[model samples]
Target: MRAIILSGAGRYADPWHPYAETSARLAELVAAAGYDVEVRDDVDAALAALRDDVDLVVVNAGDPDGPVPDGVEADAQVEVDDTALAAAMDRGIGVLAMHASASSLRDYPAFDHAIGARWEPEVSWHPPFGEARVHLVGTHAVCEGLDDFTVEDERYANLRLLEVIEPIAEHEEGGVRHPLVWAREFGRSRLVYDALGHDARSYDSAGHRALLARALEWLSHVPAPTADDRRGAAGPTSAT
Candidate 1:
């Protein structure tokens, strides 16, 4: 299948979270998974590549330095080409909104529908970057053959959930469990968002890397690993 890794910017960039390096690594990761992967930093170029044959669009960018919509105002401004993006998604292209990408394209409510969640400034907060334990919330194929694991990255919280999502990973802190990974459906398309991966180092965790690869496979409707996909999360399985 053909996949695109569109990235370059991230929210409040810093030395520790080099978006370019993270994007490069992720591109290679997806390529290793047997996809004809293309990496681009331009939204128009990426969107332009979404054709009838394109199977997946993985958004890894965030324009924290961008501007808010003409009328809406916010602390950090991250805009996206919601018009073009929503069309592709509605037409059944799989999407993976990773890390800062979830917070991207804030001005467009269409993005909320496409991503299933959006970053709510001030209200949305993350703890100091460190080891975060993400546990499985359901028996979804995206988390197939995966177990709860820990990673060193930004743990996003207080996000504005736009729909009822089937959470796959999360952590509990201060008596509240924040979802770290989730799967949702939009129109004829599917989406998976993993809140981990603050930087290149975040992929060092084997479990995190596996989840990324597996999520792509699931979103693309590729058969997921089934040998041991049933060992985690004591809950009802999807009866599909």
Candidate 2:
């Protein structure tokens, strides 16, 4: 299977995220999961490369609203066009959106719907970075058989969700639990949003790596819904 990783750069890059480091780690995991991986740091050109032959797209980008490096003007930064990327999804390519990617590709408003969530600047935030406890939730292929694990990473909370996602993993903050990892289908495309992978350290966790491997495997092989299954299915709702 061919997997394309869109590493953050230019307008999609921020000072806080080590996009290259985390993306390299992601490449290792994806390769281990049996994918021929390609990493591209130029967000715009990378999105344009999304074609029918590509099996998966891993989004390891930074928040577009975050602080840029010194001497870089935020407003003046380049905006990306996701035309090919969107069309590819419609053609049934899967997506795995990593941390901070929830806020990436904001130039396309449909991005929120694509990834199933959006990181609202003032509303969505994370606590201090450190070892965090991630609890496995329902029985889903992506997270099934995995135990709760702790890893050094930032715990994102209160992200604005745009769909009824089936959260397979979550983390607690201020006595409230927030979905940290979830799976959903976007039109014909399968999608998984992982709220981990802040840096290489986060990938060091065996549980985290296993989770990602399973996510890749699952994304690679999604069965199309049968006519009978569709007829018996409950319609979409505000929650899963």
Q: Which has the greatest TM-score? A: 2
Task: Write model 1 residue lDDT over 127-235, tens digit each, in one string.
Answer: 8998878887788878778888888888889889878898899888798998889997655678888888888779998888888888877787622223344345455
Name the runs in model 2 displaced over 4 angstroms.
71-79, 226-240
Q: Pull out the clashing pairs in model 2.
A: none
TM-scores, each model vs. reference: 0.79, 0.89
Lowest lDDT 10-residue stretch of candidate 1: 222-231
Query: Which portions of model 1 miss their true places by more than 4 Å?
Result: 10-16, 64-83, 107-110, 222-240
List lDDT for all candidates, in order. Answer: 0.73, 0.84
Residue range 152-182, candidate 2, lDDT tens digits: 9998999998778989899999999999999
Q: Give the TM-score of candidate 1.
A: 0.79
